[model samples]
Target: IEGPDLISKLRSEHGVSVPVLMLTERRELSDKIRAFRSGADDYVTKPFDIPELEVRLQAIVNRAQGRPATRRLTDGGLTLDLATLIASREGRQLRLYPGTRKLLQVLMRASPSAVSRQELEHALWGDDPPDRDLLRSHMSAL
Candidate 1:
């Protein structure tokens, strides 16, 4: 009937790896501790900021799923600088055009997961995409 009870039931019925974020009106320390001990991943009291709550939920899910918050992406000797939009391999900077950079960013972010051709096209150009198969050209450039 309560958050802790629900968490216990979920973990038992499902698995312990299930992520749980408890948002409740109970502000007491004892209540928070109890909820956590019963397997709640995060505790946010009422009157919390929406953005903060969203971030906390994302953090919990990331931890549960073993995915870190990605700023830069890297593989082998190649690296993609997310902030500066510079990509390099083995200390040598690789030239990337605007469209190619965008494609690389999207593809790297979705690494280890297959991305469909349609998704790549959507990322390159929203609804009004070019009528030609320009995605292949960008892929070649990247």
Candidate 2:
């Protein structure tokens, strides 16, 4: 993804539930850290073996699909219906934008721990990234 902002938009707007695998030639440790902080589940350096990538993709998909997963999560006054994408607090619906909904889902899943920025960006933008400033604007608006 080239546009940092678009990536942010996707993370904030779409309820992307899968892990993002970054396929890139950049191998610097700093780059890796940036990717993870952006919300990437895994980062594969370029010139990688195809077989290994396939296996990794499968594993990520399986985990995301809830193969051997736990059900239900409740925190504070909110209850999340993961399967149905419904979240409510005290039987009252909490209004949310599309991006906020996705953000909530990720945050709820990673409760008590900080979700990486890279992971969030990947979930939002995929391979075609957007401008960072634009993303920041959207987030602020949200």
Candidate 3:
């Protein structure tokens, strides 16, 4: 059976308890999408880098074991618990609204990297995004 078929079988039998990473020779977008739709956690094509593959396997294991790759991100006096969506800075708890919390999560994950306004909006609301500079409002609250 093919990789996607195998993934579908595993998902049906185990119900997502097993993390499936597809390492295949097919590099087409349709093939990748089919694997994901069949319940693959990750996919890598042929001629892959060993280090990158190992990292992806570790990430899948972490997710399957109920341990996030980064449970809490700490930089100086700030901390954000990714699992619980709790955040604090300088020994003070922050009351983050839903939009603000999402924005913070995206920003924290892309720390030190410049995130475009368009990317932020897409992250918050894909395709049918809000009009105007509404992301600014979320940023202010954050």
Predicted candidate 1 versus true structure: per-residue lDDT over 1-142, tens digit per residue: 9989888878878776678898899999999999999899899999897546745765786687899855567877778876566889899999999788777767776886888888888877877778656888888878
Residue 80 alpha-carbon offset, candidate 2, angstroms: 2.0
Stretches of candidate 2 exceeding 4 Å from the true structure = 1-68, 133-142
Pairs of residues at least 3 apart in sequence or in different chains that clash in candidate 1: none
The per-prediction tally of clashing pairs is: 0, 25, 0
Off by over 4 Å in 1: 1-69
Model 3's TM-score against the true structure: 0.55
Candidate with the larger TM-score of 1 and 2: 1
TM-score of each: 0.50, 0.44, 0.55
1 or 3, which is superior by lDDT?
Answer: 3
Candidate 1, run of 10 with poorest lDDT:
50-59
Cα error, candidate 3, residue 5 (Å): 7.1
Candidate No. with top lDDT? 3
Superposition TM-score, candidate 1 onto the true structure? 0.50
